[model samples]
Target: MNNKRFVILASIAALGLSGCAGYREKRGFILDEQLSQAVQVGTDNKTSVERTLGRPTFTGQFNDNEWYYVSRSTSTFAFRTPRVIDQTVLRIRFDPAGNVTAVERTGKDKIASIDPYGRTTPTLGRRKSFFEEFFGNIGTVGSGGLPGGGGQ
Candidate 1:
């Protein structure tokens, strides 16, 4: 009985530990060290870059001169918010002639934290209470002697 109880307890502990193990996921572009290294600044052009690194995750907001390769690894334990464990952003800039001008790399250190001030946006209008808003439009949206109203 003692040996059976011990085995059962150990099994339970193993199950609990497995349940607590975090899940990791990779998001976005997959970076290949060898392929990335093959890109040469001032030597490779847009076609070569695309051949070496495939299509970019995104291009510059305003122009196509800049290409970005973004990758992130995130882990979540149970119900906790997913946290980034590793991130890489590769930026390739091209000259007007399409030759690679520069190659830059950024890591998780560049991640930005943003906090919104409030849930509601301030607008140019009078504030109305819940009851006022609920009843305010009730009587105004009827066909009652107005130009568009069917009643004459």
Candidate 2:
């Protein structure tokens, strides 16, 4: 009996440990150093860039000349919020004729931290209490009767 109980407890502990193991996920474009290096400014055009790096994750909203390749790795353990382990943003600028003009790379150092002020957002309207809202429309709604009801 003692040996059986010990074995059961050990198995449970092992299962729990396995459940706590962290998982890493890669999101967005996969960047290869060789492929990226193959692109040359003023020489590689839009077609060549697409052939080398595939489609970009996103293009500049106002202008299509700027292409962005984004890659991120996130890690999560159990139910905890996933944390960004690594991130890279590659920006390729193209001229009006669609020739590559410049290439830029950004990493995790560019990430920004923004903290929200509060749970509620301020709005532009009269505030009413629960009781006021529940009863405020009680008299106004039926006083005039339903539209086109024709008073009998």
Candidate 3:
């Protein structure tokens, strides 16, 4: 009986530890090197561009000749609190002849054009809670004492 209990307990602990086994590395964008090699007009082809870099996130809606490579790195903790570290958008335009016509990079400095509104305005920060403002966190965690009782 003692050995059986020990084995069960060990198995449970091992299972718990296994859940945390996937160690994710700190991901970041290596954009500087890639951006330096500008897409020369009337030289780079679509196939060659894709081979050199990677698939573009977006293609121009009105025209099929334009390509946009949007690269961004976001980080979050236990909760999904996102923090954008780096963002780079490389816009490549192709001529009627299907060769690279223009290439421009839009980074932090040129982000204003991306969003006409620019940065989000800061609120007063005094946010009204769901419970306090509406119902409230009055009852305990597992308690079934609220208005709509036994649903969960």
Best first by lDDT, ranked: 2, 1, 3
Q: Candidate 3: misplaced stretches above 4 Å?
A: 1-38, 109-152
Model 2 alpha-carbon miss at residue 108, Å: 0.7
**Residues 25-133 of candidate 1: C-alpha lDDT, one tens digit per residue:** 9999999988988889888999999988999999999989999999999999987899999999999999999999899999999999898879987789899999997
lDDT of 2: 0.92
lDDT of 3 by residue, 77-115 (tens): 544545566677788888877788888888655544344
How many Å off is the CA of 46 in candidate 3? 1.9
Off by over 4 Å in 1: 1-20, 122-125, 138-152
- Model 3 TM-score is 0.48
Candidate 1 has a TM-score of 0.74
Who wins the TM-score comparison? 2
Q: Please report how far candidate 1 places residue 100 from its true position, in Å.
A: 0.8
Q: TM-score for all predictions?
A: 0.74, 0.80, 0.48
- Please report, in order, the local distance difference test score of every candidate based on alpha carbons: 0.92, 0.92, 0.69
- The deviation in Å at residue 127 for candidate 2 is 3.0
Superposed by TM-score, candidate 2 places the C-alpha of residue 133 at a distance from the truth, in angstroms, of: 5.4
Of models 1 and 3, which has the larger TM-score? Answer: 1
Query: Model 1: how far is 87 from its true place, Å?
Result: 0.5
